[model samples]
Target: MSNHRQAKDPRLQKISSQLAAHGLILRGGFVFGDGEAALEPSEARPAKSVLLVGQAGAAPWPYFLGWREQQPRDLQNPLDTWSREVIDMVAAHFSAWTVYPSDKPYQPFQQWAMRAEGLKPSPLGILMHPEYGLWHAYRGALLFADEIPIPDIHDPIHLCDQCVGKPCLKSCPVDAYSGDGFAYQSCLAHVRGTDGEPCRAGGCLDRNACPYGTGYRYPADVQAFHMASYAGL
Candidate 1:
């Protein structure tokens, strides 16, 4: 894939290099000709293609963490700020627009990933990546007015289907991660209370329990950084 693009296309390489400098990578993407079915029409624009760009492992954390230190303590949503700036710069360079996962009238990034990256859901409902498992995330996307030849999407290797016992379903003490749905209230209560130290400091227990992509798990400090933000600390 890399060689094919490098030989015939300079555009992908431009994007690839820009993202890599910040320790981010293009996760997967789709050419949104008619707009993805899951995307709310009111929220989506008439874009010819969508590039589902994101981080694959711990590569982006150092960029985020180091950048955060230079921000004011009272600065809000620093991670989102970092993502928006990085993606906006790249998109602008290519004469495209940027969208974020946390944007209002949210874009259907999950569907885009499924169509572009061949990702499936894990028991925790996070997109189960064959390589990065639950630790990966979609930071943002780039939308272009012109279509590019996107990589084909193959059937996702549903790792959760092959597991003996779904550890993520059982790892949360409150059973907040059961198949029914996440118990958001219960989870928030726990993370805000005294016994929440484990989760509050190092990320969700259930997410960490996933057996696949152990090598790609976010480093301890990075985990702690996000956990602290999630807990509003």
Candidate 2:
């Protein structure tokens, strides 16, 4: 594929459209340096652009829940399984190389998101979205040998800046979140104990406290599902 063909490629529009049905969308994309492209040595294609595809808020939870229900009961990591299947289908549709953040080699997704989307990190370490807050997630990416026409990204205005007081840091009952960082063990223990009832029944208070994207907050059931997973239940 050549740069001249990219602007006219019908597949580009199809890829974006079809993915929306599965609640996936192209988060961002960027041209890469030759050296950066070499990061995925397993893939033979010299990547022209790395496209960040992801889920925003609970957009994918419904589709994923439905997908998991049809699978065998013994299935573990149902969300991961469903996401990989969705991502694989889209990758094939566009003839792009597939990569997941959860892959063993761990693709440099943070770098990819930073470059592709011009995203900056929030207090919780999750990359904050101006519109989505911490309610979004990068499920996978598509690496293409030829550039794909994509919208230009602008520097984001981090919502954390406008926050008068960082509620996310103070909302956790156990102080699991702070400027210092998350207390992984403390958080897990608290969420598993009687005191964790609020978090378990709803979701992480710290995450939910973010003012930017409350309208995009995951449904209670979705949040509970994630909390269950977080508790390793």
Candidate 3:
């Protein structure tokens, strides 16, 4: 596709509205460059007209549970269906496009979001949605061909600040989280040695203890997948 600039497109607004109706929230920003080059404009990639990111909530939890129990041959079939629906809606507005889901490997994302954009490294256990807590996961991202108005970036709500119980910090059996940061090695060793015994049985106590995300809880299997990957198992 030509990199020529185009006028602001009305279809972008319509697409965002449609996605919101489908329960997907949108965030927009341009991707940046790698490392120190990130601070310099010369290192930047061609600014895409606009980028769309979508987040889904606890609505998919029960489906995830059923799929895990059934162990379907195509594990991702259901998620793929959901992702495709969103992508199609975005394609209606943009000609050339790219879509990314959270289940994809994290390395590329780190490079793209941090190194490229010059964004600071995300906190060890920080989850995206404040209201949903860590229970929610990003479903997909869409890129467009024309600049679209983006919502203002809001300060992340630090639910931990107001939490009285502080269950997430105390719930980990291994005490993997310190008030300052995560005890990465301790958490990894515990998960690997025990085959994720405690976590697989009851999910990550830390994540489960978050009171804010009661409605956006992830399915047990989804939580397991994330824990297993974190443990490198």
Clashes of 2: 0
Candidate 1 versus the native: TM-score?
A: 0.89
* Per-residue lDDT over 133-193 for candidate 2, one digit per residue giving the tens place of the 0 to 100 score: 8889899988888766665667989778888899888898889877678799999999999
TM-score of each: 0.89, 0.91, 0.60
Q: Best candidate per lDDT, number?
A: 2
- Poorest stretch of ten by lDDT in candidate 3: 33-42
Q: List residue ranges in candidate 3 displaced over 4 A.
A: 1-45, 60-89, 99-124, 153-157, 229-233
* Local accuracy by lDDT, each model: 0.79, 0.82, 0.55
Number of colliding residue pairs in each model: 0, 0, 2
What pairs collide in candidate 3? 32-116, 33-116
Per-residue alpha-carbon lDDT of candidate 1 for residues 168-219, written as tens digits (9 for 90 to 100): 8777767887757889889888988888888877788899998999989988
For candidate 2, the per-residue lDDT at 228 reads: 96
What lDDT, from 0 to 1, does candidate 2 have?
Answer: 0.82
User: What does candidate 3's lDDT look like per residue over 65-136, in tens digits?
Assistant: 454575565555555565666666566565535556554343244333322123332233554355556654
Q: What is the descending lDDT order?
A: 2, 1, 3
